[model samples]
Target: MTFEREFFYDEVRDGFYIPGIIKRFWAYELTILSEIDRICKKYNIPYYADGGTLLGAVRDGQFIAWDDDIDIMMLRKDYNRFAQIAQKELPEELSFNSLEVNQDCEELAASVGKQVVGFAAELLRKYHEYPYAGSVDIFIVDELEKDPEVEEHRSLLLRRILFLIEAIEKHGKSKAVLKEINEIEKIMKIQFDQRTALKPQLRRVMDKIFQEFNGREGDQLAIMQFYAFLGNCKYPRSALDKSKWTPFCGMQLPIPEDYDAVLRAEYGDYHKKVKGGGGHGYPCLKKYENKLKTLMKGTWDPDYHFSEEDLVRPKIQNFRDIAISMAEAFKLSHKQLFEDCLKGDISTCISRLSRMQEEAIAFGTAIEQKKGEGTESVRVLEEYCDALYQAYNALSDLTALKEDGIEKQKQTEEICRSTDISSGLQKELEKIANTLLYYPEKLQTALKKDFKRQVVFLPHSMKYFESIRPIVDAVLKAEDMECKIIPIPYFDKYGDGSPKEMHYEGDAFPKEYKITDYRTYDFASELPDCIVINSSYDEFNQVWSVAPSFYSKEMKKYTNKLIYIPWFVTDEINPHAKEDEKAFINMEYYVTVPGLFHSDLTIVQSEEMKKAYLAKIEEFAGKDVAKKMEKKIAGAGSCLLGEKEGEGIQNVVDCFRLFLEK
Candidate 1:
């Protein structure tokens, strides 16, 4: 069957187009991301994120929720390498098209290289009507030459070549994909010959060579070996400083050294005048807006031009003819014929729509003629207006289908909703569980068994404790693990019961709440194989000193088996009545804030965080603790903690694959 003509309708508006454009855009972006990732992995090309992609990762740890585009850059060399491999390495449905290599230049130039974009095929097919949708830009950067004259020429040449290649590739691929395949092999041969002839005009030849060998069984394998050769050309991380990039709301993009001058030359005072449509629901380019105004004023009419009168005056004449024809064609249903005529043809529809205008004009003419006092013809015209009204509505619907953004949004939401869960809260919880549950099934199994591995969970509140009971019970049932949550007292009230007691009933009863004997409930003596602690002042102080010391005396009881889990009062749990669960106290290792507490080892998000944690340990517990922590943390890297050792603890928290905000 052909592609479905289903339209995404807005339930609220009783029409199609606008509600979830952002969501559709994001989904498309993610698909692109996966395609990029797959291509990069196959080629073994290390390309650092550029433009919006990198900014989103470094600043927000994710993509901007509303962004519809994905821009990534690779070094000129890697880009060339990727181009060489794109044909064979990329999927048939998803291949890269570049300016330098592709055969079609004229078409590419016309569409501004959109047709040659790696992600264009899917985008064009998916959102054929979306005006703002364009191809993914693969910017290639080269090392700046030291000699001024040579540098300038090289830069200019590079830019010129890039533009030319982009145009060529765009047109080439468009032709290749959309071409009639009367003889596939013959066409392929002709295409290759044309490409070879155009090779010298393009910048990179090796890329084209790679494209030649791209075959069904051998593409990625060939690309991988090719990439391995160029791996050494990668630049050091210090070459790009993220802070130097240009800011865009919450994101930033790497700018040329003379960014301000470049921007001014390209589009002066870009910041002074908004470059995009922010207030409008759909993204209307500033250029489009100017064109629209001009189009409306008729000073510079577009190719497919139509003025109000030009459109209506002719339609009125056509409608009058159609009305007379309908009266003769089907005498029994003159009204129905007139009604159907409006929805049938725009030219005729317009005429039928202008009847009222014609009547008004006639009345004015008659009034000028001094016959306005008696208007039987106008009265008769007024009675026949009902058919015209229906025609007008039908035409309006057709016009609206073209302009409404909500239609695409509705379609996208419908597609996504049918395929995946859309509840924001449910998605969040799943993200959290997926992120937090290390070794997922294993963790679930561990929770299910009766291993009764004593877990020291830092006190959040009674409700939190109740919520975690399932997580803990699941782990125990899976692996016979038993967890004991460490109760911490509120800092404001010293006379209150121990934090642990708050989880139990009867907190209001003085006897039930009081910590009668601290020695009897010695956490150190009762320390199980594993300890889960929260990152709290009292817990940090105790785990860093009191618990470790008192617990050390009984360390021989269970030598090395502590697992620290940093948790928070997840949205799934009771959040209003209690604070979040921050630390997990195990018998051996305690996971707390990377910089705040000294546990056996720590879990961090990035290599940066891992370094930060090590540095913090060195500061708090001396170089020995830092070194030891580093070794221990390094040893446990296989666990799915989702971070390096020294990165920011909060980064890890944020990355926890959980729903962070509502």
Candidate 2:
């Protein structure tokens, strides 16, 4: 099978065509195999090309250019040896992941994994992880008994595995394993001791199978993961123990000495070509992982770039000019805001960010009306500038959410993902994936957009939403922001899974936003940038339920986070609030700790009020819970402002401006 041309790998690009994703996947594949080959040669430990990779070598001489996966195997002893040293042996780019090496995932699988046979561990790129890029599968082979009884047992296991695969195909990988337990319970008619969905009771069963097959002295051997698929994957030990070199993608690599025998047994027609035998790679969407990375790193050029002219453009002839001024404002405020975030000065950060959003909204309106929707450059610039402001707010709010002195690096890890163990690079990749999933096409214009900072102002009702609009607008005035203020219905957030809903007439809602009525269902399609829960007087008075006690698990779907804002001021304990006929009895007069606890950041009346809330938290939740809650409680205005009535409103407005100026 010689050709006129030699498909030799190049020094710089290997055999890959530059800028092609599939080529890149192949390049990484060869890099891993070459590294593995070096280690095996250097250590004098043997491994042979197994499965499709070997088939590719004997059949194609080069990689089946379409094939994206690489497979190799070692005998149990060699496999153990590689496992012991593969981390140090392989390039740092390659990371080892197997049930034995990654006990965390192994145990996770054992407890929650579906009824599966032993899993084949893999070596993957460190940052890429699974299903995102090319990875190597290392099959570990053990001697198998070629007996009728053993064959029947293997067949039964195969049926269960078939069921497992179907379950995953129907449901998903995450839920497939859990449902396996249920299927087993129904079919087997036996209740296993392990009860929790997250528990791994199959470890013992798998271990018994491993021990049973491993102890048997037989002529046949098989990779444990594929025992059901490949019955008695037996060959003379010399075929692998003794190896031969063959040309694979222009490199001479070891395949089993009796490669034909192995291939014939595995593929039947080893010399034939199949049209369906195309190489598959991970879901290509993650290739755009860098799209978000670039965006977050502030690499993407927004439609409007900020310049000094923005500040000088007095009359603001165009939206791009407006963007320039806004960008400059952000540039000045960003440093101060970042420093404040590090100090957990979230009160100041939130205030400034809120103001920035308001200014952006005003500018956006000018552009929308003057230039109209065709002013995409203006709109995009507005959105991106808003995102930059929101990103800062998110990070600052994140600091407040964390324990004091936690490094910003650690803070990013927490902010980027829910689980603490998630890697930094992994988090960024996930952030991109999440952003793509969370926002609809209309809202995804700016990759720099920080959904975390985009806030949903969920007013208790139309009346409450209307009442706060004045204050919200006052803060937003002159600030470059595009945050939307959407109103929600008033009801017991904590009630039967579906809470009862009520409505009132004659309340004009905020402009440019649809009122999310509590009708047939909650809004399902759109996710909020941020959910700010306003604990207004109308809210407490309208319902007998207190703010602290009124929480709906459903609201988490809208946004997993919420920021609580104290709109009502009270000096007494257990202030009974009444709206119209409905009265909320036994509501805490001094503070709304229950509602505040839900907020990543709680905006209170003043520093003195923060202290009062801390005291209340300590009294009600004890010292441990209070310590966690103290940082979140920050006051933006004085409690005495409420006593002065109209003076209070002015003071609140002044306070917002003061924060923005700083």
Q: Deviation in angstroms for 127 in model 1? A: 9.3
Against the true structure, whose TM-score is highest?
2
Worst 10 residues of 1 by lDDT: 579-588
For candidate 2, which ten residues in a row score worst on lDDT? 110-119
Supply the global lDDT for candidate 1.
0.35
- Local distance difference test scores for all models: 0.35, 0.48
Candidate 1, residues 1-662, lDDT tens digits: the string is 01111211111111111222223333344444455557767777645444444444544544443233565656445676777776665445454665555554322211111222222334434432222334455644434323446534433433443444555556754554323221322432433344354433343432332333233221112121112232222222234322244343223334334333323332345344222222233232224424444545744321222122211111112222223333333233333333433223333434545654354345334433432434443343333443335445544444343357678546533543454454542343233223312222332232223123344444333432432333343444433344444443332111111121122222432332322232244543343444333332222221112232323213223322333333321111111112211100010122222212323333333354355445544544567655656743432221223333443333433322121111
Model 2: per-residue Cα lDDT over 283-304, one tens digit each: 2323343443354475431112
CA lDDT, candidate 1, residue 81: 73
Shift in Å, residue 494, candidate 2: 54
- Model 2 lDDT vs. the true structure? 0.48
